[model samples]
Target: MSSPNELPPAIFLDPWLTAEGDGLKALSQTIAERVERQISSNLSQSARRDAISRRGLVVENLVANLAIMHLSPHLENRDLLAVATAKTKATRYDREDYPKRLLSGVVLAMEELGLLIRHPYAFRERSTTVAPTPDFAATIDRQRVKLSDIGRALGAETIWLNARTGEISFADRTPLKCRIEYQDTEETILLRDQMERINAYLNQSGFRFDGEHQGPVCLRRMFLLRSLSDPHSFNLSGRLFGGWWQELRSDRRHRITIGGERITDLDFQGAFCQLMYVHLTGKPFPGDPYAIEGLEDHRGGAKLAMLTLLSRRGDLKRLSPELKAALPRGWTAKRLMDAFTRHHPALRDAIGKDYGVELMATESRIMVELLLTLKARGIGAMPLHDGVQCAASSGGLVAEAMQEVTERVLSVALPVVEKPVVGQEWGYKEAA
Candidate 1:
């Protein structure tokens, strides 16, 4: 293993280093070994060889261009593939499928050789334009690039790579740059600084530092602290409404007062809020309601909520016509719950009947409608389990419109706590 202090020498551009050259030779040998292994292990060797042959040709052509560029630090999308295919032909590997196989083999080798780094968060925006953010800068510095990161950054987690333009994208979002360049020493320093900055930022944000792992920072815990420290600001209908509600509930440390009733833990409250939101918006909740931490055994509540609003035969007889009209069409109480499970497969096993009773008893048509209207307007809706996710498009009118919707919904929900309690005193009280 290379020491932290040592840097790998630039062997690709070295001329004096013959076949015995350490870096280039090693890279070549590794590529060869990978191709050989792939060819040997393929279920049908003949078909594999044919495919590899064609792919190899393309790769050769591409490499030829790279040779011309002298393996320059960065290769744009078009140039990268072009050069690889050219190299294949120049090397007299004229198979039709050579380019495809060669490029795959090369990428695989580069990864194994540590020549290619994956970024954690690289993505394109909706404007068919790719703009590199501080996060991307940090990622390029880290010597790793994940294609998935590119998708997430653009808010389009599922994008297709364009074959014609060599463009990678999601939801009409295009990348600003196809690839980033990072040579040996540059990557290390960049990653170090980026991580340091991230840690510092987290600390400065008043977030209690917890241990770091391989995922998003423990913002949940930090948000919990923020909620506890400032109950008013963190109240369900206050500034910290919607998505933040789930985090408060999950940790079991946050509480809020609604009317004169002091809600001790936020679990049931969050679930209730989510159901109401779904009922209002006419959109399905993304996850199984039962999967929510404290609600696991109460799938029935979610089911009942779905039935009340979605089922035709549901007890909407008591609700105003305006409210009844908001229910899903052609749905029946019996099948409404099943539909929820079908639409969100991830929640299939988490809930059942007992939950239905709770939902029916506590159904709030007004609140549900309010949540749905906010959602239809593209405002962010925090369901019971999912964290805060942006529903609006990035930038411009769409984003602003959604923000407006969110503010309006918050205005109504937040005031519910301010009204004088009919039979009880208002304000926070200790749990009995």
Candidate 2:
């Protein structure tokens, strides 16, 4: 609910950032020693020694995470690394690797050493946050950490379930992005194996976001599986998440490159609509799916209506103001729905239903097929919902590959729209 301008960026403390090379490992060791010495001098000797000794790895691991955050090209000094600690309810189902008890001590010790400024929970919803003090930055400065040797994020479990109702619910039940773990079955194993392979390729893909930072700004992209709506609802919405590029708007994402070359992005035109239509009717819709009477000039309205029609559950009821603005003036919600259904008669019986999850599952599988197909040829890409971002030189190949893979996945070749990085318009159609 809070706007981006309202709060400072909180880079979550990632426990997965381990010291990669021996040089960084030694640096973590050196930082851990300084923390231990400082804590030992201030606190009771036996208690500090025993407690710190018991969780040596935890202390260094915390140090490593903080170091990685600071060294990251994606971040500036003002963006603080927010950590969760000593809050039993907050971290109940969190992670076994980064125990709250051990981390709480490290946080306190670091604060005691004047290396961190701890912000107690501002509200019930937030974790206790911390920003490194000048002394801590000076410590990193003394170590001479470079961007090239900085990001070596070891891979971790990538398959996750998000039962947030929308990955939108921050309610206590699902809590913060509503991400929950799922029991992996044989089918899930297949999906996991597929995602793991994609992650592996991505780790080595050499893709960079090319942000304002002078150095390479790679965000350790490995596509993770996100099945939404329910953890128990296994086949519901299996979408690919975790690529940082997916977060960028098209204009900003124009800066992304694979191996320092300029980029090209290909989006499947009317992908999900095509998916649902072909899937339900066993044949593609004949005409332009967005074409309809009365709104011929406003294709944007027709498309948004089609989207809302598929995703909006329950009664048609009312249109949101944003939706209304897109549509013809003074048209009632029912009238717009009627017009849309009449135009695409095939989806008439399917209106007011929850096909959004089903469409995501269908689209994710289509993307997986395309991703794996490209990976096979050593062409790397970042998978969007119904499209992919790849090297500009590979644009033509990626477009063709997408056509072949979508045909195999959905039994119909969905149209693809090719977008060059420097282009003004949305995209040019590779095929219709």
Candidate 3:
């Protein structure tokens, strides 16, 4: 086996293909032999062999990508199909119905190796139907051990595994040059250094949370320690919209802690509405932005309905299933929109305006300043959509920084919504 000290093939650029290509070839050949043996006699031996080899080649290319998903468990089938099609140059993958066929094949191969188990992933933000295996890291560690033996026999370093996170980085230089549409060139270059710095900070300061939390929940929580995209600023709005933080289930958000201090979440009240009101009228709303005239009892439903209608530009016919499901039983999208419009006339008029984009940019500016200010003071903080979380002891400091940033960016004073202190009474403290 290549020693840990031996540098991996520098050709990780293609990731699916490596400088020492013999190892992948050997692995594919072994899988093909197994698949060929299992084929029914309905196909002739030569035909069966050819089919198995084709399927095996696809499987060999996908192994590394699947292994890397240990860190980002929410990858959808469509995204995987895009990657597979690009990597294998398989024309069949471009078909409209290709995702189901290709993903099922990949799932079957991984299951045969006891590498993955499918779970129902029903997040409102995700359109995909399946979740990555919760045990992806453990499974990949076993594969890495097995592949180490295979590498010893082959006498080459074809696999590049990060033992710490079970993240598999590609060592093939060729395939990586293919362009992806959403690739942010600047963030892509800085990602590695960002991870290293975050890792060092977390390891040195120690991250602590409640022990009663389930393992998978805790795994998601750990995403705060590493970011997938640029953290220097927000994605579109003042909010940091991308990465593991945005995907974390709301109930589990309060579990994060640092240096024995409980973390508290603080956000602006009626975030978008207040911002929009300020933008149009040059003043914040006097009361609840979500308060409907006679339908005050349905504030929560009213708020959601208004946001949905505004976001879709009052296209009630094409309202998403999730939005439709959020309303009361008898309420249709059109009915909800009519009710919200009657009560919020000014907001209704403001709909289809360019204010939302402006709101996001303003909020993003506030967040950038907050983050930079905290970083300058050597304080650790995390961003939620309209709020910031930090060690409970630093709550006052974080709040002051946030207010200062908001006023500086918007030329207005914004209201704050402080979430109750978390992990304080539970006898949990940051690790010493």
| Number of the top-ranking candidate, with TM-score as the measure | 2
Compose the digit string of candidate 3's lDDT tens values, residues 1-432.
223223211111112321123443454455545544543457677976666655665555444334333323223122222232123333311322223234455545554654444322224211222222545445445444222122111111111111112243243111111211132347433532343343333334333444221111110001121123324222333234323334555565566565666677777777778777777787777877777654466666666665555543334554455555655666665676677677666777777543454566566556656666776677777666577767777777777777677778778777776765533343222221
Model 2 stretches with alpha carbons more than 4 Å out: 1-11, 21-30, 41-82, 86-97, 112-117, 122-124, 132-148, 151-155, 164-181, 211-233, 286-306, 316-345, 423-432
Better of 1 and 2 by lDDT: 2
TM-score of structure candidate 3 = 0.53
lDDT of 3 at 186: 71
lDDT of 2 by residue, 322-409 (tens): 7889987888888987887788888887776868767877887788888888889999887877788887778788889988987887
Global lDDT of model 1? 0.30
Provide the lowest-lDDT 10-residue window in model 2: 216-225
Task: Kindly indicate the candidate among 1 and 3 with the higher lDDT.
Answer: 3
Off by over 4 Å in 1: 1-103, 110-210, 213-296, 299-408, 414-432
Q: How well does candidate 1 match the true structure in TM-score terms?
A: 0.22
Clashes of each: 61, 0, 14
- Model 1 per-residue lDDT tens digits across residues 1-432: 323223222212111111222333333344445555544444486886666555443333322222322322222221111112123222211232233335545544434444333222113211111112334234333533221111001111111111113343442232222211222245334433433333333223221112111112211100111112232211121111112233332232122222212222111223443444443453334443435232244454444454444322223334333322444444343454454555555434334322332333233222333334434453432322211212122112322332343335433221111222233343431111
